[model samples]
Target: MNEQEKSDGIKRVIPARYNRLMTDPLLREIVSGLDGVAEALAAKQQANVLFDELGTPPPDYAREAAGFIGSGKVDKDWIGRVAKDELAKLVRAEQRKHVSDLINGCLTQLDSIAEYSVDDVLAELDTRLQELVQPLYAAGEKLTGVDTPTDAIRRGLTEEWRLFADAAIEYAKIRAAQKIAVSVAPEEFKDRGQSAACEDPHANSSVIANIAEVWESWNTPPQAELAWSDNDEGDRVARWVRPRVEAPWPVQTDEFLLWCIRNDAELRVPDLGQM
Candidate 1:
C-alpha cells in the first residue's frame, strides 16, 4: 500500500471508509453475493421440509439448489404453510417461539424455497464424512495424509473469509466510513437490506414511499426541492422563487432499487396466499 499523508490543516473526523463503501464495486459484489447466499439457504430450508414430508433426505439439495437458480421465487402462499411444517419438526418441548410466530402471522422464519445454502451443504457434507470416517477410525486407521471433508470445507470457508476481509480492509483503508446502511441491492435481492424503495413503484411501494417521504417532508416534489433559507428563529426560511433540482441522487437510488426489486424474482408465485 502506498503511504499517503493526511492534510495537516484539518482534524475533522468523518466516516471515510463507510462513505467509500457506498459506491465500491467490490463491496457491491460481495453484498449481492451475500443476499443470494441467504435466499438460497432459506430455499434449502424450505426444501428440507418438503423432503421430510416425502420421508427422504434431499440428495445434495438437488431440488432446492436447482429450483433456486432456475424458476425459484418466494412463494408468499406457502410461506406460512412451509413454516408450519418446519415448526412441527421441532421436538414437543422446543417449539414455543416458532409456534408463537406462526400463530401471530410472522412467517419471517419460514420462507423462500428456491436455492441451496453453501454453508448448510458444507456442514452436512462434513457430518456425513465424519459418519463414514468414524467407523474406519474405530477399526484403527489413522485419519491423515489427505484433507478430510470437514477440514476441506473449513479450509475453503476460511479462505473465502480471508478474501472478503481483505477486500473490506482495503476498502476501509482507501475509502472513508459514512452511513449506517444503504438500500441498494442487486437483482434477485430487492428490498433485502436497509429500508429503501424498489425502482419500480409496483416492485416495492415502500421504496417510493421512502423516497417520497424524504423529498416531500418539506413539501417538495420527489425529483426536486424548493429553495429555502434559515430565518432569525433558526428555522428554514421559505424561498419559493429559487430553481428546483431535477432528478437528484436519491431519485437515481430509487430507480436502481426499483429495477432490482422488479427483476430480482426467482419465480413468480401466485398471489393465492390471500386465499
Candidate 2:
C-alpha cells in the first residue's frame, strides 16, 4: 500500500482498539469514579455532604442549651469557637478520604493498562489516561488542605504516563523502519554499482557517525531542522540534521534517517561536504 493508505490504516485501527480497551471493566470503573468526583467538586456538593455526615445536634438539647444561655446572659464566643474547631477536623478528614480514593482508583486503572504493547492503541491509551487523571488531580488539589497530597498524585500519574509515551514513540519508529525496509529493495541500490572515484568515500560514513553521535547524546527525539547550502562545486544540496537542542535521540538513529531520506522527498540527503 502507499504511504497515505498505510497512515489511514493505522488511524482507523488505533481508535477501534482504543475504544475496545476502554470497555474493560477496571478502566470503566476508574473513569466513572473520577467523573463522579469531578462532578461532586464542580457542584460544590462535597461540603454539603460532609456537613450531613457530621449530623445535627438533638432538637431538645439544642433548645435547652439556648434557653440556659439566654437565662444566664452568658457570652456565646466560647461555644462558637469550639464548634468551628470541630467542623474543621471533620472537613479535613472527609476531604482526605475522598482525594485518597480517587488517586488510588486512578493508579489501579493505570496498572491494568501497564502491560499494553506500545502501538497505536497505546498512543490513544496514554491520551485517555492523561484525560482521566488530570481532572482528578485538579479536584484533589482543590479538596485537600495541604499541597503534598495533590503533588504526590500529580507525580505518580506523570511518571506512569511518561513510560507509556516513551514506549509508544519507540514502537512507532520500529514500525516506520519496517515499512520503509520492505518498500525499498536492496537490489535497487546494487545496480547503481561502485561509488564514483571523485565522490567522498567517507561521506555516508561521516554523516552516519555524526548522526549516531547526536543520537547518543539525546534524551528525546531531536527536532531536526532542514537547510540547504551550496557545495564547493556550486551544486545546492539538502541537509536534515537534528536541531542543536538538549533532548533524547530517536530510536535506531541511522535507520530512521535513512528511511526519511528514502521515503520523504523533502528530507532527501544532499551531497556531503568534506570532513
Candidate 3:
C-alpha cells in the first residue's frame, strides 16, 4: 500500500488527531495523565464491589492474611497489598471480555488489511503493539534504523523483534492508524469484526473453535507472546502478556488516556485568558 492509502486506513479506525497525540510530547503526557485518572476513577466507582466480598473469604486469603499477621508485617504493607490484589482481580473480571474483543477485532482487521476498503485491517499481530499498530509506523523507526516506514519494516525483520509480516500499508490515503479497534464502534466493521464478550456473556465454553482463538489475546508481539499474564487475576496464565488496561492504576490510566487522545479525542478548548 502507498502512503495515501495507508493514511486512509488510519482515518477509518480513529481520528487523525490521535496520531498527532502519539507523536507530540506534551499532548502525549497529558493523555497519559488522563489514563491514570481513568484507572483511579474506575476503581473508585467499583470500590463497593471489593468491600462486598469481605463477607466471604477465600481459603487462600484466610491462610495468607493469617500468615501476614503472624509475620509481623501487619501495618499498611500487609493490608495494602491484599486490598490492591483483590481490586486488580475485580477489574480483570469485568474487563476480560473487553480485552478479548479488542483482540478479536484487531485480528479480524489484520486478517485482510490489504483488501480492507474501509472494511478490513491487519491479521494476527502483537497484542499491545497490535493495539498501536495498524500503521506500526512509530515503533519501527529505531528498531530498523530506517527513515521511511516501508524500509524500516523490511529492516525490522533483520533485527530481533517480529511485528510486520509485510501487510499492505494502504489501499487508500497513507498515514499511521491504530490497529486494535477497542474504542471503535462495531458497526464500522460491517459485522465482519469479532463479537464483543458483552453481547454474549453466556457463550458455551465447550464449543470447540475449529480455529483456535489465540491465548495472547493479541496483547503482545509474537516474540513476547511467550510471556505470561495474570488476566489481572493475580495468577499466571498462558501465552499472553499483561494488558495495559489491567496494569496498576497509574499505568492503566496512562494507557487509556493515550488511547483516547489517539482514537476518540475531544475538542480541547484551552482555558486561555480565562485561566
lDDT of 3 at 66: 80
Q: Tell me each candidate's TM-score.
A: 0.15, 0.21, 0.18
Q: Spell out the clash pairs found in candidate 2.
A: 218-248, 219-247, 219-248, 220-247, 220-248
Worst 10 residues of 3 by lDDT: 202-211
Off-target runs (Cα >4 Å) in candidate 3 are 1-63, 66-77, 92-97, 112-275
**Residue-wise C-alpha lDDT for candidate 2, range 1-275, written one tens digit per residue:** 11122321211112232233345543333333432334533443443455346543323335556776779865567467557756776775566455444533433333333223223232343344334333333333333332232443565644433433454454344334322222222233321321222132222322232433433332343567888999999999999976544223224433233232332212111111211
Largest lDDT belongs to which candidate?
Answer: 2
RMSD (Cα, Å) for all candidates, in order, is 29.1, 25.3, 25.8
Ranking by TM-score: 2, 3, 1
Error of 3 at 173 (Å): 28
Model 1: how large is the Cα RMSD against the reference?
29.1
Can you tell me which runs of candidate 2 are displaced by over 4 Å?
A: 1-76, 117-275
